[model samples]
Target: MSMDELKRRLGQVSDLNAAAGLLSWDQETQMPPEGARVRGLQMATLEGLTHELFTAPRTAELLDAAGTPAGETDAAVVRVARRDFEKATRLPTEFVEEAARARNEAHHAWLDARERSHFATFAPHLGKMIDLARRRADLLGYEDHPYNALLDEYEPGMRSGQVRAVFADLRDRTLPLLRRVTAAGNAADYGVLTRPFSPEAQKAFAWRVAGEAFGLGPAFSRQDESAHPFQTNFSREDVRITTRVEAYWPACLFGTWHETGHAMYERGVAPRWERTPVSAGASLGVHESQSRLFENLLARSRPFWERYLPALAKVAPEVTAGLDADTIYRAVNRVQPSLIRVEADEVTYNFHVMLRFELELALLEGTLRVAELPEAWNAKMHDYLGLTPPDDARGVLQDIHWSAGLIGYFPTYTLGNLLSVQLLEAARRDPEIAAGIERAEYAPLLAWLAEQVHSHGRSLTPAELTERATGRALSADPYVAYLHAKYEDIYGLKAEG
Candidate 1:
């Protein structure tokens, strides 16, 4: 029961977990329809084995004996390992296997349901997923709201009430801003984006931007296509991301940058902590901050398009024929209500996240039933965005999170959006970082994040990391201000008080 033995045991568990992640990455990206059954069993077995190994009695004994470590890195390793071990030990192996199997099956069911535009086809599977989530929260033990337990899994120490408060403030400010933009009536020419750009050209352009513009290392990182854009890593040296290209101009470009943001953080983690528990991003919220920062603040910036539009024009000359950087920036930033969350413009995207958070909370609390979700979702969309999806594919079934049992995770998208601006503000205060960004040299900015955010990994909580890096706790003010200034300039609307 020594520290060395504990590290060895945990490394094996990490390997198994990584193997399972690889299986999932393939399931979404490359697996055939017939492979679903065997993939489900394979994933379930791997998850069960990893859970058992981590929650074993000897692992507990070693954790107790290790107690604490003198070095900062060792202490972080022990702390994160202890937290994960305690959580894992609370769930039975049977529950672990069942959840894995259900998630796998539900994912396939969702795909089929989405294809057919049928909510009923996915309703039963969704009901089982909801039940599984509630059971998990119960097993984890919550003080006030069961949803808090699930929320804590992704964002440690964040509560449902905290998310509600933040969302409420954001919603109030956003509604008026959205209304103003709508009244302006397409001041920016977005017609250029809708022009036919072949998928082949789109993929090549997206890859170039991801590599050259985003600085995702070609030697260690790669981008592929998937049903949904996501990033996964076996190690920092072997990071992989997938982005979909489906005629929408910004989907492939910004999607690639978003996932690259995730991968770049992984690639930038301290090499010393590789294969250890603390080697990933500090938390899901922090992780999303990187993606949102890159996707919106950088990729969508006028300056970025100024530099990259020529390269893009070479690939999609028809689309970029009359488009300049200013036009492209305003077009991409155009505030239009949309059915798809991923395609929603920055100003309206969090409304999409907020809607999902509310629905998921109600579902977990048993106030909402699975059969009623599609209707509920449509109502909320209309309430928030003044648009209703014509089918389940564009409505309730668009996202893959629920099928994968990722309840209580949507709020982090907004949290990340808020934190992205705060983090950027802090980084910009550093003259060196500011100049680097102005000059389109991202190394300084990336290096600063590595030192301040990425390198620490799970060694610090999100609040602590924010406070240490940004000199304040998380806030919605920066994000709101960013939206107002950027949108007002684009749409030529008067600023709100």
Candidate 2:
């Protein structure tokens, strides 16, 4: 088949995936409680169809027939399609459909289970998902570890052992920094965020800042609310993010900032690449870097609040009641060991991912059972962050990942945190981006990412993209140094040279 025919075929597969993606977007946003029953089958049908279309014998024939591509973009299309075909062909359509149905059913079960704080209701579903993941890993055939098979799905070319080493280094460095901050007590007045604020005002101000401050304008991108905060896109033209609003102000403010990072990156992908395999961000880790960068490196910084606080004050006067940028910055950056991963402070956040990664490995290995998850989870929480859960809602049932069959996805969160700082360091080296950031104009930074990371999409591997953008491979040093300097200043603690 010709290159055009290859792209046309890939585009058709992309369209099928897009249709399912729209259903997923609604599944999280607008679908009613009863809709989940049918939604599972609906999504499963789409999954199976896309799998069949992508993995057909003709795809491999086409991939081989395409001679050396003329450009990076075309080469990427052929290359990515081949990689996907290898994985897709490993599983039968029946397996794909079953996994999808299981994921959909488990997702709904998770929601209901979380609301009731009952793990028993969700345990059987989680077991089914875990069993499915094991079967998938077996089908995919990993050499070192079964988890690596699943991990590669989200972060291609990344291995579980590499993640383990990185996490160990990160945990060692973070613990000392967290200790100093904890020892110093609360440096920023926690009262600023802990106090009640209007949910409406919070949403409006956050949404405005997301569009204006971060450059994720609503022309092609939009924001809404969901049970959990996430960003999704059907194509570059239509990107969506959902953030939960609650009594705690940061959930709306930072959640919007985080998802805006994702939406902006999605919206920024090169238009010519649409409906191709390379259309989306490089990987979930790379995608998470954008969200982490926007959430912590940009919006969470003092420079951002310096300009936006008054705007927030305009909408919710309570936020700025005698508070200045520095005070608010310190408060939002406070080191608190929390039960919820999403609500975790920066210093302790990766520990949450580590806990989940370890738990996932165990669950996948049959060393841990779904029934024993809460106890194991509480123990890890105590071991890692010095906190215990009062209920399963804040414990095992807190995150929607496991129930949705996202077993190998947790480690990407930490990878993103590390890469976010790495990307920020690289961008700030550009005088234009640095100036834009200080002035609360994000276009330069966004444009820099568009040119360097976003535009390439999945054309480049995550490691290659990180190296090209940052001039170095992924490292925890930059992220660790970043947290130390920022927190030491906030808490008035001295750091070891």
Candidate 3:
């Protein structure tokens, strides 16, 4: 009876989260512009109520009654719920509501600011966001750095020191290979990707790949258009992915595949786990691994294009009139320094992530002022990618993370990149998965990941999941080795050092 009651209470929390998720989805997709004012209040009210109910003294009594669970699933439920309850109890209900309001207002302001290519319009909100982040960190308490508190929210048990060490090692090892790739003058004929295609045609081709090819069907999950591409779900059975359509086709095509990866992870979680603490991905980094694995490893591989290029031709044959598999593969894999993180090539992508990670650290540490963010951002772009943003849209305002109060989220993208390679190498070891990749049949591969990674949900930590899935601790060696091999094959330059 006690376990049953605990489950019932946890189910209520999930339902509330789903309610908030629906509000956020509508605000992003369908809500009118002026509705922002009321929407923020609605979000805050839900958030406050959610926090209060979860942290009530009654929950403590229930946990004491449940005691130590014996079974694996029951143990996980008690353990995670207890951890969350302790943390939520530390944060006041007013803080929760205020943070939600700040996030909502700032999100709308960010849309307008990015469109206008203005940072000043969003600076005050970012300041408030940073202040709230600091306040939350203080409320939560931290040992070494306040940033650790925020980062731990996304990557459990991870610290800024650990992230710094990992990124430093990655940058030291990969930058040389990146320079070699850059110095090689064999530029891909990337113009093929930027050619004009009608929006309707682009949508049809992209969703076909997402739905028919990638296994995200209309019944369980669907895709939509948003200013910035993202995937969110109220439940495993009701996943939604969104992307922006561009005149250039790669943005929509690759973006759809990227988000489909996230949707698949959410959809693949064991259905019996829904409305529970363990219903989501193990961690944001692990979640990112799925997205990156699908986006880069699978979608951009030679076999994938070989299989899907024909399908694409049937949908938008004008763009592929004279194109072949090798050309499309090379075009998609071209290594170049790009101003946008989303468009960055595989080799240079982490540099974009690293830049944001460092800037976020500085912001949280109070070493950098919010007003000086654009200048700091431009400097990092020049240092890391050898380019400078000409405007705020291309610079500090490019990402919605800060405006939406996602302070510690940027580092997970790089962690996701590293884990993506580690997980793929592990998955490919299975002969069925290996052959499935060779033949462009992803069912075996997807099934492998569903069994290995997605099915557990939050039952394990990122490290535990990485070791279980890959048979080793998370290391940059596989990722670096993968880069060296793939880029050397493409550019005819060995970056061995």
Candidate 4:
């Protein structure tokens, strides 16, 4: 097939993928419980069709012909599309459809189980998903570990061992910092954060702040509430985000900012690249970086509160009436071991990911059983944080990732923590930009991000993108240093305790 033919085919595949996404979104946000079976079939059919289209004999022949030296007309286009084709061609259509159906069903089961606080309800479904996932890894084939096949789905050319190497370094450096902060104790009273704040007001506040404060333009975006806070995009012009609100907690606020960070990255992609291979963030890790960067580095900062707390006070005057900026900032950043992974403090948040990474690795490798997950999760939580959940809702069923067949996705959250700090180090060099945050003007920082990172779309690899934007390789130093500096100042503890 010719280069032009390949491009047209690629556009057709993109349309199918977009349709599948919109259907899944509806299932999650608006579909009735009775619609689950139809939604599953719809999702499976779409995925199978997508897999068939990309893996057809003609598509493979075209990709190979165009990618070869004699037939290569445009090296970049051939390179990107061929890479995708090769990866897609390796998996079976049956596996793809099965995985999609299992994922959609598991997600819905997870919602029900979480609401009922019954891990038993979701256990068998998760077991089937994990089994399907392992089959997927085997079909994809790996030289070292099956988990590598899963990891490549999110971060190409990356292996499980490589992820473990980075995670080990992070754990070593982060644990002591956690100990010191624990010893120093939480320096602020976060009890006020749980006081009554209306859900309607919270939604309104989150939406306004997403645009006005976080640089997420309302022109291309809309915010809605869901069982989980997430951002999904059809294109730069149509990005959608969702968050859940709690009348007695601060989770929705930060979760909104986190999803908005994701929305920003999606919305910031170059318009010229829409519906192509180069249309989004470089990888899941890089995507997570944008979300973490906004959620922690900018939105949770003392300067941010100084500018926005009064506005919050106006909305929930009873909750924030006499609360000053320092008090609120400290409250938002309070470090404590928590049952919910999504609501954890910055210091302990990655620990949650670390546990999931280890557990998923075991589950995929066949060393862990589905029926034993509840016990294993309890033990890990006890070992890691010295606290245990009374039920599965706050334990094994806490995250939406695994039920979505996202086995290797947990590590990216921690990787995002590392990426965000390095990126923030780069962004904070401008004095004017730092002052802009204090004044609640985020355009300078947002523009810097757009210029430095977001404009590239998915044209670069994660390593190349990080190096170009931050002038450093992906590493543990920036994150460790950032945590040391910030927590030491806030909690008055030495790095070594």
Across 1-497, the per-residue lDDT of candidate 1 in tens digits comes to 49889889878987998999999988988888899999999999999999998999999999889889887888889999999988988999999999999999999999899889998999999999999999999999998999999999999999999999999999998888998889988866778777899988887887887777667877997778887789999988889999888777788878888898899889888987887788898889999999998998988887888888888888888988877888888888878999999888998999999999999989988899989999999999999999989989999999989989999999988899999999999999999989877766677888888899998878899999999999999989999999999999889988877
Each model's RMSD to truth, in Å? 1.1, 1.1, 1.1, 2.1
lDDT of all predictions? 0.89, 0.89, 0.89, 0.84
Please give, for residues 359-470, the per-residue lDDT of candidate 4 as tens digits.
Answer: 9988987788988898998999888888998988889998888789888888888888889988888887899887786787888988888888887776788888899988
Task: List, residue by residue over 1-497, the lDDT tens digit for candidate 2.
Answer: 48888899999999999999999999898988888889888999999989988998888878889966888788888888888888889999999999999898888888899999999999999999999999999999998799999999999999999999998898788898887788889787898886768888888888888878777777888778888888889998899988998777898889998998898888878888899988988999999999999998888788888988888778777768898888888888878889888888899899999999999999988899888999999999999888899999999999988887998999999999999999989999999889988887888988898899888888889989999999999998899899988888888888778
> In lDDT terms, how accurate is model 2?
0.89
- In angstroms, give how far residue 218 of model 4 lies from its true place: 3.3
- Model 2, C-alpha of 437: deviation from truth (Å): 2.1
Q: Please give the distance, in angstroms, between residue 403's alpha carbon in candidate 4 and its true position after superposition.
A: 1.4
TM-score of each: 0.98, 0.98, 0.98, 0.96
Which 10-residue window in model 1 sums to the lowest lDDT?
Answer: 435-444
Error of 2 at 357 (Å): 0.5
Which regions in candidate 1 have their CA more than 4 angstroms from the true location? none
What's the CA error at residue 422 for candidate 3, in Å? 1.0
